[model samples]
Target chain A: MHRIGDAPKVRRALVSAAVILSALFLLLPLVAIFAQAFSAGADVFWRNITQPDTLSAIGLTLFITVLTIPVNLVFGVALAWLVTRFRFPGRRLLQTLIDIPFAVSPVVAGLVYLLLYGRNGWIGGWLDTHDIQLMFAWPGILMVTIFVTCPFVARELIPLMQAQGSRDEEAAVTLGASGWTLFRRVTLPNIRWALLYGVILTNARAVGEFGAVSVVSGAIRGQTNTLPLHVELLYQDYNTVGAFASASLLALIALLTLATKAGLEWRAARREA
Target chain B: MSIRLKNIAKTYGKAGRGVSRALEPLDLDIHEGELIGLLGPSGSGKTTLLRIIAGLEAADTMSDRPSSIHFGDRDVTHLHVRDRRIGFVFQHYALFMHMSVFDNVAFGLTALPRKQRPSSGEIRARVQRLLEMVQLESLANRYPAQLSGGQQQRVSLARALALRPDVLLLDEPFGALDAKVRQELRRWLRHLHDELNFTSVFVTHDQEEALELSDRVVVMSNGRIEQIDSPEVLYRSPANRFVFEFLGDVNRLEGHVHDGTLTCGDARLDVDLDEGSHELLLRPHEIKLDEHPTELAHLPVTITAIAPVGAEVRVELEADWLAEPWLATIRHADFERLRIKRGQRLYAIPRQWHQFPAANQRSIASETMS
Candidate 1:
């Protein structure tokens, strides 16, 4: 007996349509980036990557991603733990607040931070007295990248931790485990997979953040220009090969992230089986 | 260790809105090495009381009388669960999923402060001994996800016992297992409790489990203790209507008594009672089915269903007088002698009955048919 939508003709048609659409829309663009980067030969692609501004852009992007991950990891774990484990007056409201970074446009979030911390802004004027420059600098780019990537870890964790419940933690405490010991030995082990998945997502978002960082970085060549901003700069300058080379780098990182995620999921499924 | 609870109560949610009472102010004393069972239906606060005793929840503080808990001579009302030295087994077996059976059981011992932590060799020996006691020594390397429900529960029990806690609390320890496994685990837990000689209290909704495993059963309903007595006393003489009904299957006879005869619909029984409205309760075993109406009763009933799977045959009886179906359990010999079958009409004779008067009067009157 055939199940719903399981007729041979219809199944073949649907499967072919999905495969063709994915190949054309998703796979074509990824292949084009590397192809275009190497169109002018490997020597020009190598020269473009070795440019001073391009090197600085890569360094700044790596710095921001490195800083953003640890900060958000701590914040996300703490927030998820608080929301899932305890009952408070504003718990529902706090849960809603966690989605602000995801709900609002990244550019709008960058603007909000700029309005609060930029020169001539409310807190920025006070900071200007102290000569603490935040906006139009590396700190500004890092802050906005953190803002855009804040929710990934927490969003990945909250539902999983909620489903798992606090019973193991409660049992640990009753067994004379101290606060830190319980978190390390019981809570951490239980949440390690989800936590790792969340960290992977946060890293992906942090590395690829463009809209918010672009709005704040001021695009100072070799100074605040991250990889995405530098690629746009190269494109406008008619350096097509250089722009594609940087895009290829970003695509490589995305592919690596996807592969790692797939590997983790396969391992988790095998463990369950 | 013996346990004491004084004026313990719990009110959930914030005051004024969404507030509900979970437990009422009550006191209880548990003797050392005693296995007590808190038996009640769902939402009866049995699990809440057990959690409170485990320090997982705090009892409300009454201004007039402060709530307190004591373990032997130690006042532990405000003590943290980690410092109170108690072990709790969750209903779901809350075993650490990532840890092997050996690691799970050795967790509490290894988690002790460095000063009090046992040596690795000693911890290993203890965990092996616990696994041997639970008869899971061969499965020590398996994770919780790889084990069956019964196995996971045994691991949970061993983990709870590894700490050598003064009191061990289990919340519906066997509620998640199959009937056969539940029975086996119940006997095994009793044996372990007796051999170890540690105080334990468990919560359960199954009456047979509570009656079979507990030295004394605390029957509860609506957040109050209806009675606390040994299983034999609790079964033989329940304290109130709630206790009697909650303990086991009960058949109700609601009618009016006139001139020592109680009549309900087309049924009548010679009952010793005042001339007024009365209700009587009868247990399944107290009912006897006969082919002809007896002089004392004329409770005509039809066998709606019959189940002879267990040691005793259970027969379902229904009549125009009953608001609900009644059950009568008889021996296999009697079942064979009567050759009872479904749709067969029979007379129900009450060998014994109990009566509780109306509101404002709390007393039990037991009568036996002569």
Candidate 2:
């Protein structure tokens, strides 16, 4: 009567292996971050967090994330709606293109933006004459962060929206609901959970993004340095506790995002059941 | 509303690379308050035609004669689905999952423009009335997920009727329900259609549903309408072979006809057919079985299977002449009198049969027992 992989010995072994691996690769690092951050006592950790440069980096990171979330939210919903609801030429191509951010290395995307909008680059030369500084500035940091985080919301929504289909929206329209009314009442409610999950993911990626931001931001302290980039700067300056302090902040955000995602998934499953 | 569709057609792909036609340019006139069933198998353009009538899809315009649709006196070919003032019930119900049954029913009323919208009190009363009509007032507070499939379907019906549309279109409305639930829903929908007096069109592949529910059934196949008639007329006289085959179970009698007789293997039947290969069709009910062979038909068959269900007993017959098994339906009394059983040998007599010749297949020649 035993099913495949259902032996007590085998099941126990698999469960224990999974738990050990998770503890080593995931839980241990999270614990180590807070441990190192407070190794020099709470005062040093507090000092590192309250430093003017760290404060500025935190503010800049929050600003970029706040802007990036709404932009990607709108883009993701619109893209998911367009590709799922309508049939047209190049729809498959557009769907594939949305995953470009996920496929291309973040640093390569940053370089591409730099080459296109940097001072010596194509669009940058014209902008430079107008004194528009995109690269090596807060705008450059924002741009690369947006590039890395753009796909999260859309990626989360596409499969879900596709599975749900457009029948509800079509029903609304046939019942005298206008475009905006249908979207607001039917489509929005249907996709709200996935949309929120996407935004949380986008926020997490935007806050933690370093590779692309470093390529474009030039890591100017208190000016264009994001939180992740500032952590690297502190680490390179031989400040381990300071580095871990910033990393702990990121770890908290990641934890919060994971919690929110799990909560949303649990609610969604209950609603479906 | 009376619906008139003129030269409506649909093509799926672009013109150059293997464009497939979903529907041909054809015209149809549906009378006001008529409950028409677009009966067809899958990919038969019944749904396409319904969507075109609902303005959910645009019919292709021909170069010579442009396609157009009309609702009563209003020309609605160019109207959006929202502006067309039609109600559509999707196959899967498509009730708003987050909304309660009451809220789902009230959606169309609340979605109206501010100037045209009814008061919240009026909307609530209307929704309540709709829920009552569907016998779902008790479940009005429940979300769609909390309801059974039948309850969800009723909620969708209430939602569609909330707008008080002149025309209601349903795509495979009861296709998802169990047999008993589907039957109940079909009767309920028919009652609602009669009471509301709306021009209703529903698509279904089930012949029994179409025949029982529709005032007129439009039998379609291969993107073409084979026949449009009342259930009685459709059952009694189908337009062609496709219509006959699609309507109900048809047993084929294929053999060479010569000198007023058709012969296949050792079995022979008296047939007044031309001297050539011919095929005859008979309904299960049109077949009769006896212990001894009759002079008119010496068709000997072995009783392979017996299903004594419902009001009749269905007997499956097999013979050397039959390329496939033949089914005969007899009354329970007859089944008992004959005491038929599996593996028993019997004689089959065609009480009535129909023939649709290969050439000029539209004409039907039917013969009944003298």
Which clashing pairs does model 2 show? none
lDDT by residue (B193-233, candidate 1, tens digit) is 99999999999999999999999999988899888999998
Write down the TM-score for model 2. Answer: 0.96
Candidates' chain B TM-scores in the order shown: 0.96, 0.97
Maximum-TM-score candidate = 1
Fnat of all models, as shown:
0.91, 0.89
- Model 1 chain A: weakest 10-residue lDDT segment is A186-195
lDDT, model 1, position A250: 87
lDDT per residue (tens digit) for residues A22-83 in model 2? 99998999999999999999999999999999999999999999998898889889999899
Off by over 4 Å in 1: A1-5, B359-363
> Using Cα atoms with residue i matched to residue i, what is each candidate's TM-score against the true structure?
0.96, 0.96
Query: Interface RMSD for each candidate model?
Result: 0.8, 0.7
lDDT string, candidate 1, A1-273, tens digits: 859879899999999999999999999999999999999999999999999999999999889989999999899999999999999989999999999999999999989989999998899999999999999999999988888888888998899999989989998999889999998998887788888898889888887888988888999999999999999999999999999999888889889999999999999999887
lDDT, candidate 2, B1-370, per-residue tens: 9999899889998889999888988889999999999999999999999998988888987899898899999999999999998889989999998898899999999999999999999998889888889999998888888899999998998889888888999999999999999998998889888888999999999999999999999998878888899999988878888888898999999999889889999998888778989899999999998887777788899999999879999999999999999999999888888888899998998898998876326646556453
